[model samples]
Target: MSLGGETAKATIAKFAMAAVGFFGSILFARELGPKAFGGYYLLFSVTKLADRPLMGWATASKKQFADNETKRRELVGAQFLFNAVWILIATAIGLLLADRFRSYSGIAMAPFLFVVLLVSESNYEAFDRVLTASGRVGLSTWTDALRSYLTLPLQVFFVFVLTGYAADGMVYGLVGATVFTFPVIFYYIGTRPAVPSVDTFFSLAQYARYSIPTDFFATLYNRLDVILLGMLLLPAAAANYEIAAQLTAPATFVATLAGSGLMPRVSRLRAEGKTVGQEVTNTIAFSSIFAVPIFFGALAIPRALVVTVYGPEYTLGVSLLAGIADTVYFRRRQRH
Candidate 1:
């Protein structure tokens, strides 16, 4: 547990993931353009919300079985069962709401596509919590980040070369990428420690109860503005808002990586009778030092980047990017 080793690995994963996400965003934005990009963003947001039940079960299972192998396995099984129920329930709601709001701005998916997409996405992602609880954030972060990067070439080719379908191509690329990596992920899961059992599920009731609001609040914090923009502004304006906000996603990813890496070390230090106040201070000081400059720089160059990088049509809301950049700063500050 050399601090230097942990620090190096975490830094590499953080910057590498952001770099990949950055280039991928450019490719994706170009492929999607404004209109189709907006639709893709909206659909992804909705599907993300639909994933909370799976997330809740995962979080509960991970926490409950953090130290127990048999319990962990049972918890995983229950997580799948519970997630299935929610997927079914959400499918029914999607059928009704989609028919009623076929022309809606933010959510224009087919009757059951929302549930189907989220279920597929979440089922794989849910294991992430388990990995994290097992102190495998190192593995989780690097694996997922690498997976995202691996998906980008195909996404670029499929969206631009084979099909000019924009958002559809983007979604297909995602599903296609996940499909390709399924075996690798499952193999990794198998190699990791397992705690297979049924009773672990029943012991997790309390943790599941607490996970609901945490998941909802976290989702809303990240996405409430998108929902609000769709309702309050014109569709075009809302699309602009989404692009602006999404540009800060890399910043969010960086902060998450930093915080995740630091927290466990800080916790261990505190347990070993060291005061965490200095660590907290150092974390904030260093984060702000690196983060502030990048944010301001991005704010200054939003329009040029949006136009030359994404497309000319995306220049509709330069101010919004700067605004969202500040949002990321404040968000990091508050969390830190």
Candidate 2:
């Protein structure tokens, strides 16, 4: 399959993930009382933010990974190592600060931490990275499909049927789902593992370091709201906000897919000593044009969506999310 074609398939897979996320958001709101939901959302958002330490390494990593097997192994292995470290540190800090945290769910913190640190799920990006770099487009798409579509239904089942406690059940489902990605990533790496020769380790670290700050800031912008909400509002209030955000997930997948696909291609052009002007243009214009509608439409009728999906109890934060959607759609993402 062609690069764009493969990327399109990956985008479809991401939409499936987005569907899971979209539905998962509603399921959690229903299963947990708003308060518990709030706590869970806040925590999940923070844990997600911690993942930013890897920065956009997935994108840059793909660049190096596209070049050589040894380089790929070292880059991926080091990134995996770094992701583990950051996830652990963040989870520990979350635990240590629990009592002080207004958004603490009564649920056990360790399980969520385990999910955050899961090797299989956490390294999922590596699969697409390897596939994109290797030009194995269609296979790359399948892996994402496996992760998203396959895992989503199971998650819904857990949330709606098995446990019915959104926070716990959703986490259980998500953790279970992540197991599917590990095999795909390993397989993508093929026989020649990205083993870190000492040189490669340094290469990995340097690359990771360069990408960390931009991702950190970008991630913080995404999750910082949840953290602040945990501090400022009650959990249910936070959850209500989360509900509005949930509606945003599916559509945002388009931007994500665009950005992800654009990166590897841009890297290839650079490799061929080509200017990446069009690549950057396509990524930006498309991301902006794509993200604008979903974001604004949600803002236009946030309360209706929230109330319809999660029940009337979720009405309070609709306006806030609506405002946020409007602000961010036009303001924050126009540049990149």
Candidate 3:
């Protein structure tokens, strides 16, 4: 498919995922209320922070897979090994710090749930990068949409139908959805594990050396605020900040779409000795068109938007939405 077609499909999938996530967030916030939802968000943020290290390898694998098709199976095997080791180490660290995490997050099962979520999320990230790297950008995005759509009903079932699970139910629902989708992702990639080559490890390491620190700081920059609020203040405070952040999150969609679709295309073109100057230029122009309006629109109606969508209880951080929207707009520009 042409780049335009691939991006259009990806955009549709992302829109669906965003719509589902937006409504799901509102439902969880209203049903769980501020405190429980905040606790869940706090744990969610922690998993994001913990998963940063894997992102380096995931990003590198995407680039490597796109650049060297002959080594695809080797890259997959090496990444699988790396992820397995990382999960074990991360789980051990979480266990060691279990008590501290519980006290800080104010959730008794935070550490245990963290381990489950960390593993599931890491698996999803790995698979997502692999699919995108292989140039199935639309399929990659559809998998994400499937996960989002599946997660909401499962969360509702666990939280309400099962009774008493609350925030923990949300975690279970997320993990279950991810696990359920693995077979589809696996079938698309269709590579059985080969013996990992030593050369492939070094090749991945070379790319990851630069990507790792970039992923780490990016994760920290994006998530540190919520982490701090959850730790320093109450979960409700963190929830307020999260509400503002979520409301402004869609501003970055254009940039994300450009990045996701362009990277593999650019890498492949470079591998074929083709210049990508025009592609990059076109993406920048396209992103700017949508970004400016979204930024201003959010600034204009922060309070009413929040109240109507998430209800009045989430109005505490209405003032922060404009600033957060601006931050998201600039961040997207910087990334693009």
Against the true structure, what is each candidate's TM-score?
Answer: 0.83, 0.83, 0.96
For candidate 1, the lDDT comes to 0.65
| Candidate 2: Cα lDDT at 186 | 71
Cα-based RMSD of candidate 1: 3.5
Q: For residues 91-199, write the lDDT of model 1, one tens digit per residue.
A: 7787777854345443344344455567668877777666555445566677776667767777777788987556666676676666666555556655333343444
- Kindly provide the TM-score of model 3 when superposed on the true structure, using C-alpha atoms: 0.96
Predicted candidate 2 versus true structure: per-residue lDDT over 197-292, tens digit per residue: 778766656776777677778778777777777777566767877777766655565456556666667667787798888666655655654467
Candidate 3 lDDT by residue in tens digits, 205-260? 99899988999898898889899998789898888888887877766665677677
lDDT of each: 0.65, 0.64, 0.84
* Error in Å for residue 124 of model 1: 2.1
Q: Which candidate's TM-score is highest?
A: 3
Tell me how many clashing residue pairs each candidate has. Answer: 5, 4, 0
Better of 1 and 3 by lDDT: 3
On the 0 to 100 scale, the lDDT of residue 18 in model 3 is 86
User: For model 3, what is the C-alpha lDDT against the true structure?
Assistant: 0.84
